[model samples]
Target: MIISASTVKDTSENVEKFVRRNLLGGIDHLVIFLDAPLPDVEELLDGHPDVTCVRAHGAWWGSTPPGGLNERQITNAALISRLVVGFVWAEWMFMLDGDEVARIDRPVLDALAPQQRAVRLLPLEAASRLHPVADPTLFKRLLSADELQLLHALGVIAEPKQRSYFRGHMSGKPGLRPSADLALGVHHVVDTGTGDRVDTVKDPGLRVLHYESHDGEEFVRKWTALLSSGLDVAQHKKRAPVAASVAALLSLGLPEEQTASLLEELYERTALDDVESLTRLGLLVEVHPDEGPRRPRPPDDEVAQLRELLRRAADVNKRMFKPRARNQRAPALIAKLQRGLR
Candidate 1:
């Protein structure tokens, strides 16, 4: 089965590591869509025969919605999806965010090979090593398998919790059939025919390592980018209050320096100490290394079923409901009008 993976990234940090990890995980090809110009992109792709890089030149930016999906994610789903479908000849395709890494095994690959099937992976959020103010370059440094093990052993970073307060945490990226008419998301795919999400292969073996907020500098940069983009503050007001507040503040002409400072303070107050404390308390468990083949989930064909159901409903409606006569009136009403005229 031909399986390919694609991601749209602007930053140089973790790009090489992300590509290498997917290649090692048995993905047949890697397509990188650069949202912004990265100078070392050519050198980065030089040795990898399977990897391809394409620069978007801000085409993806204009497609961003006011509320729902961010520009980067929309670009990935709408822009990169087309690119992958057009050029890459693959039975199944996986979408990865710039900071996310997929850990796919043999059985998972086998599960993904079937037609009319999509596999949803789990997400593991990685914790940062440095606190307060940390360098962005620290994220660029590749963490060896041994180093990850050591960090887990030392309780510096713990395995991601299976549950999240955020929506769609359990339902991660979809490995989709390329031919399906669908609108892709980071966690799910909406079938265009039925306007419903395609059923997912609910296998625990498929996991994505999400290195969100790698360091203070990176965190600031990410938030700054979002704030500057004029992201809809009202959209995230309930789901993410802090983000909404930041957006509101920026929109109100909050200076960049002041906004950055506020964000740093908020980060320190909210996540930094809490993460350390939780690790110390052993609230977050360490994920053990697994060398065995991962298990495959049964195929789900709910998308096809839903599409058929919708078609039948439409047909039934068309046959049962007839158009009214243009000038027809109720018999009693017509008689009353005639008597009134007389």
Candidate 2:
């Protein structure tokens, strides 16, 4: 299976660790699309034979509609999907967030039949009491004993549980067939040609372990960063008022108030004691490790070619959409006028 992800500077360490763990888990290739420029991206991948890094320059948040949903996260997934469809050779591709990992019970390809256009993996949220860690291996070790939680059913609507806490808990992410003309959303996929939902298989064993938040401080920092990122003007406008209220509360040193009112309102705090619940139900179990041979590194020239493609894509994006000064003439027109005068 092929793995794809998009990331920024703050999440680089987590992304690296995620890739390493996946490689060890027998994933054949990894393609990382960086939304922001990270100078040490290649070094972080450590020249892994099966990894390719692409630096994206376009405005990733442009396509998302104004809502509470994080445009950056959604657009990042879409960008990775676009790239995978354009370049990846794998039949099965899994797109993941920097803080998410997929636990596969069987070989990823073997788990999903060839006829399936996509597969949905249920999400298992992880809880931590300490600050967010940089090492994935260490984080996994910590979470080995840490409690796991799932969103509680708020009510019953037409026989379906109305759970609105985590956005992705109900509709899981699509493990796509890259060859198909599919348009990826945050937690779903649609056919690009027909504009219809793709045929998907639900795999009970393929689960996503999400490190949603590490602690109260981390949660605040995450929200603050999201508010400041300027990815969605509407989202920013909507959050600015709540953030002002939260800031006032923080200045008064009323952290408990902030956690109860602001944090709880934004994220789900219902502790279902999922680890124990799943254990008692005989549902939560570990996946078997795949002991496959180490993958061979791509040819040096192939890596060079991929780098060249990234460079060209960046240049084209800059030329097409880099902001211009007010009433400024187009660059191409200015260049042509200057050449004529010369």
Candidate 3:
């Protein structure tokens, strides 16, 4: 059976969507750990079939958290990994974030050969919308190293670092076979007892819909929270280049309005501005995420001050994201992308 776990603190709308999508995608069970107590979200999930809600603040962490985002996620996932393997007796466990949904339409582990102990589902990051709304219709996939180099060389991607390929994580999360020899991780698995990283094979039939930053507001919330928090961004080693930039941004300590405006500018610049160009080069994938049950998606729900601030700031200086007109250089760029992938 395929089970999934997440450590989350998000608006109920996002959480509810995550639940409905996973349910429709055929996940056998879902366990959510609320990093902070979210009564609205928890109540929304209460008594739901095949879903277990665990509060992370209470006895889960001895009544005090480790004071960092990564620790909280890793702690909760490790605990759940033990529970699933030792007591729940599940065959496979997937670690997902609240913004991510697994699209498991076909048999995954069930169809895998016995020797494939670990697997990874590539991520399709949600594309940004011109208006401040989630673009559930379009998502972008990561490029192979060759494609990335070509894009950088052709000046299609302004930033030559890893972040240019995809704004969020490209190291996709893991789906693992439970065993005493392995330990669960935030992104991948490790050899238990040895603390060594274990390798994973890419699963061909599975994909994770990663809404890492659903909109301009979400982009502000995520980056602002990180910059404001005293935690070291370097903790995410794979994102060191990103971390360096974040560190530089943090050093500025600009006023909230200035920071928000600058962030939105950056978002507009880096986000999907030319969908047609990427699509023509076979880089973009269009997908209509499963609209979970017909119930309302909790758009009008109340959230804490942080989310409210993001919404207002993002709205105050709103800008439309019209795609740039195709230029003569577009054809050559597409040719470079296609030819390099070979």
Q: Which candidate achieves the best TM-score against the true structure?
A: 3
* Candidate lDDT values, in order: 0.49, 0.48, 0.63
Per-residue accuracy of model 1 over 1-342 as CA lDDT, tens digit each: 334435454455467766665655545556565555677775676445556555444433334322323544443443333223322233466777766766666566565545646777666555543363532221112234664555566654453222222212334677765542554556676564554667877565776666566556656665666555545545754336656655566677778798778777765543342355445545443442222232221122322222222222221111111112111232233233224222
**Candidate 3 lDDT over residue span 75-186, tens digit each:** 5565445433432236677889888888764455678787787888789887665454445667888777788777778777875665776778988888777664565678
Query: Candidate 3 has which clashing residue pairs, if any?
Result: none
What is the lDDT ranking, best to worst? 3, 1, 2
Candidates 2 and 3 compared: the better one by lDDT is 3
Over 4 Å off, model 1 = 1-9, 58-72, 75-89, 111-116, 128-170, 230-234, 237-240, 247-261, 280-342
Backbone steric clashes in candidate 1, count: 0
Give the lDDT of residue 110 in candidate 3: 71
Angstrom error of the Cα, residue 43, model 3: value is 0.9
Best prediction by lDDT: 3
* Residue 165 accuracy (lDDT) in model 2: 27
Write one digit per residue (lDDT tens) for candidate 2, span 284-305.
Answer: 3343322334455445654444
Name the regions of candidate 2 deviating beyond 4 angstroms: 40-43, 46-49, 58-88, 105-108, 111-113, 130-168, 231-312, 316-342
